[model samples]
Target: MEAPLITADTLVALIPEILALAFIAVVLLTEVFGSRSPNLSSGLAALGALALAGSATVLLAAGFEGSFFGDGYVVDGFALLFKILVGLVAFFSVLAAARWSARTGDTGEYMSLILAVALGASLLVSGRDLFVIFVSLELATIPSYAMVAFDRRRRESSEGGMKYLLTGVVASSVLLYGLVLIYGVTGSANLSEVAAAFTADLSPAALLGLVLFLSGVAFKLSVVPFHFWTPDAYQGAPTNAAAFLSVAPKMATFALLLRVLIEGMPETAQAYTWLFALLAILSMFAGNLFALRQTNLKRMLAYSSVAHSGYILAAFAALTGPALETAVQAVIVYAVAYAVMNLGAFFVVELVGEEGKSFNGLFRTQPALAVSMAVFMAALVGIPPLSGFWGKAWVIFATAQAGAWVVVGAVIINSVLSVPYYFGVIRSMFFEEPAGVGPVKDGSGALRFSIYAMAVFTVLFAFILGPLVLLAQAIGL
Candidate 1:
């Protein structure tokens, strides 16, 4: 018998998406009837994201694990954990945008857009079928383009948005074509069926489809060659949007990549490890090299993000070895580590002006803020005890344990390469001098609170490492 499209199981699996949709409606209606207020909209939207996160947590605690929609969507430890993370990033995005959107005069629109991206990300992590993956990715991606261009006051915002949009369209089309090709080869859209269909060899069409799909995901991860848009977009978009774009969507996309490769294409996993290794190396080199030369805060951090993609990719290179589970755990840990530290870093940029000189001698005026920023930078550099260090440490340990020393060396070299630039931010903050003839205010209260919160999390992440490992273990495919 054919299954019904909607089921009690489907409803249980989709509590986050349902709540996100309902909150979007409420946010819009309130915006239409009530006075225009950035703080109000930001609060409502962040509350919605938190509400969705709460729902996911409750579901996870209730042991809500299942394959719904004919295995197109999954509710498991893996997806549940990421849902909570994405929600947090969603909250941060709204928190940061409150002040940024005050001048834009449309908090309601951008806030809703942020929630939409959150909804998409929540769904993308659970996506197991090609159709669900494509649809969810687009849902997450389309809103990002609008958010990037939302700051019409700046010509660079428009330019960045257009560049991002144009490139995204091409990537989407390519990805869709690949999905269609895969569907044709497998004669099914479900990942289990596709996995069953793979054999000892791939036809030319299947090979081409694999390449296309990876290329599309590479665009999202800001992998080298396709990463040109990253720095420009971050530099051009509002810092709040860049903050959201950098971490949340990336976590979700990495989840999607894992689902596709491990679940949908397991037969080819060993064969693809080499490709991942090569890409990881290239991304590390290109990202760090370009980042070293960038003087702009957003652009440099943007490059750092690209380099980070490489660090995470190193885990994927170890997927075929006996350390497979370790590799997976490393990626999971790296995602959280990157999230807290990177979001803290970008939010710091939101407070300080974008130029490197704006941070010169920040320690002289705002010691606390400068110190908070230093933690984030040191973490990004993979310095000891900080979140970034833990993330890269696991990546290296996993690769080395798997005997993938080339990947290990690449990671080590890149970590060393990154130290100078990441430390550059700290140097400007402490050693140099602040710009112009005005007292630097410490930015909005909400923004400052986020910086402080993320800073603490980055510092204290080591305490949670054990729990993170257990969580990763529980995330059995």
Candidate 2:
């Protein structure tokens, strides 16, 4: 009954979270005590994000590894990799938010919420206990609910936020019930302990709990059958909020799924692998087929995101023993590629109007942006010499190695199915006539930086595949 001693390493492990909390404080204080300047609040948030990234880099270089708080938290190569990603996403998101908040003049709450969500996501990837995972997931999600409705002037924003909130509440309830059942059966909330408990035959309650857990996670991933809210939420939310929601939350949820499934329930991998396969096939066909008919760019991208989730889930479905490590690598690489291209695409949509017609004559007016959008589109379609191509190729290869032929076929068919919608945007941008007279206004400096930086990364990611492969292998360890 002795209290466990806290160590300096434990605090160091939490540097990112601590920095996020401190930044949130600074952002909120600036809102109340200072001149209420949007630029200053956003600048502070960006600085905090950079500092966190820098701290993560320093820690990663130091080669620190250990569990803390009775193994409730962990610091490993996997956690470090994701923390770095979360920081990068937060850095760009705040930069984008600065410009967005300047327009809305809601600097304080906006910047704080971004930091709050970032903190939540960072914690989520590092959590090793069920309680920690659940709490971190909520932390990441709740602020996003408000962000979706930040543009109160728009009825679509309110409607989108409401739907997102309601769906999330139900998902959370289902997930929690599953967690309770698991805890009751395993008599532990720690993932390692739960996994050890599964060495024996699983009970009916445990199986039910597992199904419920995955069902809840599917809602977050926005896969088919649980994805009714995605288009409305993305279309109704502010463009930047949609952008952040598209990447950050999905990354965190995937990380949570990986941790829970791989680390917490390895014994049940074979059984659930088929479940993920079924979901993957359904998501791919549903997303791409639905997206083909969409006129609005936001809604199209929403469906496209669902398809991308299916691609990652396909890797999960191929999680047999020999293929498990490769599957992990595919997920990591694809997650990064998807984040880059998807965010870049969304940034383009934010700059151009959200309607497909808005891209007409883009090549004639903003040729550089038009080309950038084209790169993202081509990458999305899994064309060669782009990051997205490698992502999809690896996943399909991994699936093939696992002998999940059906998932592989679904992936190939879905990629072909996706070409029309992705190319439709390109055709509009390059081949169509202008709807207006002059060039479309390029957005703020931050927005431009985000767009171009992502574009360059997408194109150049092929060159860095070696390092990415190494990182992915490290995560599998």
Model 2 lDDT vs. the true structure? 0.88
Q: What lDDT tens digits, residue by residue, belong to model 2 across residues 1-477?
A: 765668787888888789889999998998899988888898999988887777877787788788888888888888888888888888888877677678788888988888888888888988889889889999999999999989977899999999999999999999989988888989999999999866436789998888788888899899878999999999998888888889988897898888888888886876668889999999999999999999999999999999999999999987787888888889888999999999899988887879888899899988888999999999999999898999998998889999999999999999999999999999999899989853345447888788899999999989777898987786564
For candidate 1, the TM-score is: 0.98
lDDT of 1 by residue, 2-99 (tens): 98988887898898889998888888878899988777888899899998899999998888998988778898988999999999889877887787
> What residue runs in model 2 are displaced by over 4 Å at the alpha carbon?
1-3, 199-201, 437-443
Residue-pair clash count for candidate 2 = 0
Best by lDDT: 1
Residue 49's lDDT in candidate 2: 81
Q: Model 1: number of clashes?
A: 2
lDDT of 1 at 121: 95
Worst 10 residues of 1 by lDDT: 434-443
Give per-model TM-scores. Answer: 0.98, 0.97
